[model samples]
Target: MSTGRARRALWRWLPPWALDAGLVALAVLDAWINLYDEGTPLIWSCVALGSAALFLRRRFPLTVFLLTLPMTLFMDVAVAPITALYTLAASTRNRPLLAGCVLLNAAASTLAWPLSDGFAGDQTWTLIQFVYTLATATAPVLFGQLVQARHDVALQLVEVEEAREHERALHAQTVLARERAQLAREMHDVVSHQVSLIAVQAGALQVAAKDPDAREAARTIRTLSVNTLDELRHMVTLLRASGGKETELTPQPTLADLQQLIANSGIETTLTGGLPPGISTTAQRTVYRTVQEALTNVRKHAPGARAEVRLWHDAQHFGVTVTNTAPTRPSVALPSARHGLIGLGERAELLDGTLTAEPTPQGGYRTELRAPTRPA
Candidate 1:
């Protein structure tokens, strides 16, 4: 395997001009071996011109093939005419034209030079020679057509792979939009109703309470309720839109939300280090989600485990790491689609980052994300 690769590498190092020159040299050698004994000045000139015509075969395939025919008549030279015929066939898609060229090559090879000598020969012998020459001429044409077909099939395979990848991306986006719409319906039906009742009761208490502190507390509750309701409406609107062109999800979480997320995680977690300010919002969100998913998994899979969330930065990059100790108690099985880590990995890839999750030597699990500090 290594030897084959090394040979191919060496072949690639040769320039196009060098390969063409080598072919021309081979054609010249063929002419010399066939015509060196009894060639006239005209026949020698014909051979020379035919050999030189191979240089321009790639650019003018039909003209080059025609140039080689005179030498095929005067001298029995194989290299120049076969190479020209192969070039013409490979470069053209006109089957009728290629068929005509093959017949012309066969006729030239069978007939004797000076025209009259061919008719003077035995008719049966001439017919037999023509059949043999015709069969030989067809070999290069078939080979050239095979090469062309292989090239076209390769291009089509590349296009098919690209289309399949595009379809997969569209399917994933559709699934995500459907899930968001379902979540929006749940929040509107359940959470909105409960919050509305809280706001109404708080308003009534503010109006009826006698003590100032009690009334003030009721007023605060009503105010907070109103704000929460407003935020929920905005979120529901965004989700129901299904990411239309006119709207985008906004106010995404950042590093500032890390502490609150950990405190509410219901796990014994310690946060260490800090990220530098001025990082992109997308990067910040990726960091937040990595920690969130890691902690969630620890709570579900590693029962009674202690977790550590660490934020660190270097000269070129910054990210977060979440690690949890092994489970201290048996965990209850829960139904899960198991797509959370896959989603986080895809998100990190969009920001030119990487996510790695694996078990540690101490029987714990670790999830880490590393991203460029200034992504393009």
Candidate 2:
């Protein structure tokens, strides 16, 4: 991977406790080197205690610094308290109070040791030693503050990155939703053309039928087909308007609308059961569309066939079955986009369901669907 990604991956793999352990090790090493140079047992013990306090710096930073500060003044120990002060400056929010106390202590230590009367060295060498002590004492605090500033910048970058990721996800969802609406409009248009043809034919039949039952059936078929065309136009308009501002939407047809559907069909269609219990609006619409598509296909390709629609509970799931026998006459030839069954299958899968459309041995067609009784 690239450098930035590599660093992020390594940081993710490394735990915070491991870094704390490394800090403990550094503090112990610094204190041990001082003790080995010219240290007595009592001084060594104090150095060890101060080094141990460094382990607790992140948890109780100010407390650890207070405990180690006194050790530096009298014991001549160097690393333990300096590292503690570095941690305090790096991690804590309060800085000025710590800097003031640290400067005062450095002054006291310089006066007590390097510039004391016991020093028989030259005044120039004493001045250099005082400068060295002041510089060394101030270095850690400066470095720690710089580290803190970098850490704050990293946090802001991380927050900006997360916000961008969330925005991208929402944009993707919006695009997918618009695509679905467009596809639905296309499907409606494809089916609406055939339905309008049936309405025109049925209007002709309504004028010629002699028996009361045949006339009434012909009238119902034409009326329902015209109604279907109107609904399809409304859907297309809604889909087109979706590209601009939001528009008022109508609720989709539910399974309850199938009564009018079967009545209006010229074929003798029998609907067996009402909608199953606990069916959501999504599944209800799926059921309505499944029957609508199947019946429409029967009208186009198997005109005057006997069809049956049955809904029932099968174990923990609900089942919808639409079956039609062979047509009495030859099937008509319309524009065949031929994706209706594929779309139905996808809709079934969306509800954790399955759809099977196949021809029967009697040269007929059948479509069966199974959907979960509960929403997934």
Candidate 3:
């Protein structure tokens, strides 16, 4: 992999033990400097012990502090690096633990001041040495703290970016699902009505060959087939280039399109209720398809039965109900229950709506679609 990617992978897999080992090495170096080169072995040994205790900073911060405090007192003042003390400070994320550790470090460092007379020869020299040593020792600790803070910031940035990516993915999925639903509705509107017209006109031509009506039936079938091809072509164009220039596609049909649907049903269709102006495109398109499917099924299954199409909409919900009068005698060839209603069900579900199909008590089939106005 690339260097940056490999480095990130390595950092993620890095074990805590490795970090402890590195900290221990720093402590050992400081300890050796104190014990081998510093003034007295007793005081230097104490400093070595205290600095060595820093290796336990992550696992047992309290224990590390308790063990180090006494050695810090005996050590020549401020012999240990401030980084070791900073590690102790960093281990305690709690404010109270940090406050207590700072107070203890300051008190211990001050208490050891009497052991160092190198500063007593001159007040200015002593003060300068103390200030320089304190600053130098604390520098590594402050640097480590800053590094830890930056690490925390980087982690938070990663979390936010991950959340944004997840949200974008979810949104894309939702859009795709809705588009599929719209495609199903479009296919249902195109195929069912066109196929039904072909069936009706072809059947009429069989019985009326001697009359001009048979020729008209033939013409109507040709017209419907052409229309079906045109609609299919429009859909194919959209799919080919993902929706070409706007003029190539027709405007999405709405309630206004229902008149042509009812007229083309051939069966007497009585539309009773009004639709709301504020109905959403999803709800409107769903209603249109539900009505079309219901009417197409009525033509296939009930043949000559009268159909009643009702649509009512208010501020909260849009509802559609299509019911047909029962046939005088049940046809042995009622349309098989394979296609239309199932597609409607999926469309309704996408909008958090519902579709129900059942036999009316009066003997005809009834299909109802209920869609809410508000998006969930």
Please name the candidate that would achieve the greatest lDDT relative to the true structure.
1
User: Candidate 2: lDDT of 135?
Assistant: 75
Show where candidate 1 strays beyond 4 Å. 1-10, 207-214, 238-376
Kindly provide the TM-score of model 1 when superposed on the true structure, using C-alpha atoms. 0.60
Residue 88 lDDT (model 2): 78
Q: Lowest summed lDDT over 10 consecutive residues: which window, candidate 1?
A: 241-250
lDDT tens readout by residue for model 2, 1-376: 5999999998889886776677667766766665566666765666566667777888877787766654464444566667777887798667786677577546544553323552665768757766776777688777888889888777556545544553454355355546856776675767877898899999989999998899899999999999988888767644532321223465567677878878886678888976566787668777877887788678767856899999877557887899999987544344444455656676687678899999999988999889778842
Identify the runs in model 2 with alpha carbons over 4 angstroms from their true place.
Answer: 1-48, 101-105, 113-131, 146-158, 181-217, 223-376
Clash count (model 1, backbone only): 0
lDDT against the true structure, per candidate, is 0.83, 0.71, 0.65
Instruction: Put down candidate 3 lDDT per residue, 1-376, tens digits, no spaces.
Output: 5999999888879886786666656655655655465557665565566667766666766676666666555553343335455665554445565555555665554445465654357767656655655555455456656767776677556545654554454355345545654675666677656666775767567567776876777767766776776766556434322211122256755788999989997889999998777766656777887897788677656746899999887787878999998974334342233445656776677567899999988888999998787742
Query: Residue 173 in model 3: shift from native, Å?
Result: 3.1
Sorted by TM-score (best first), the order is: 1, 2, 3
Who is ahead in lDDT, 1 or 2? Answer: 1
Provide the clashing-pair count of each candidate structure.
Answer: 0, 0, 0
Candidate 3: where is the Cα deviation over 4 Å? 1-45, 77-81, 89-92, 113-142, 206-376
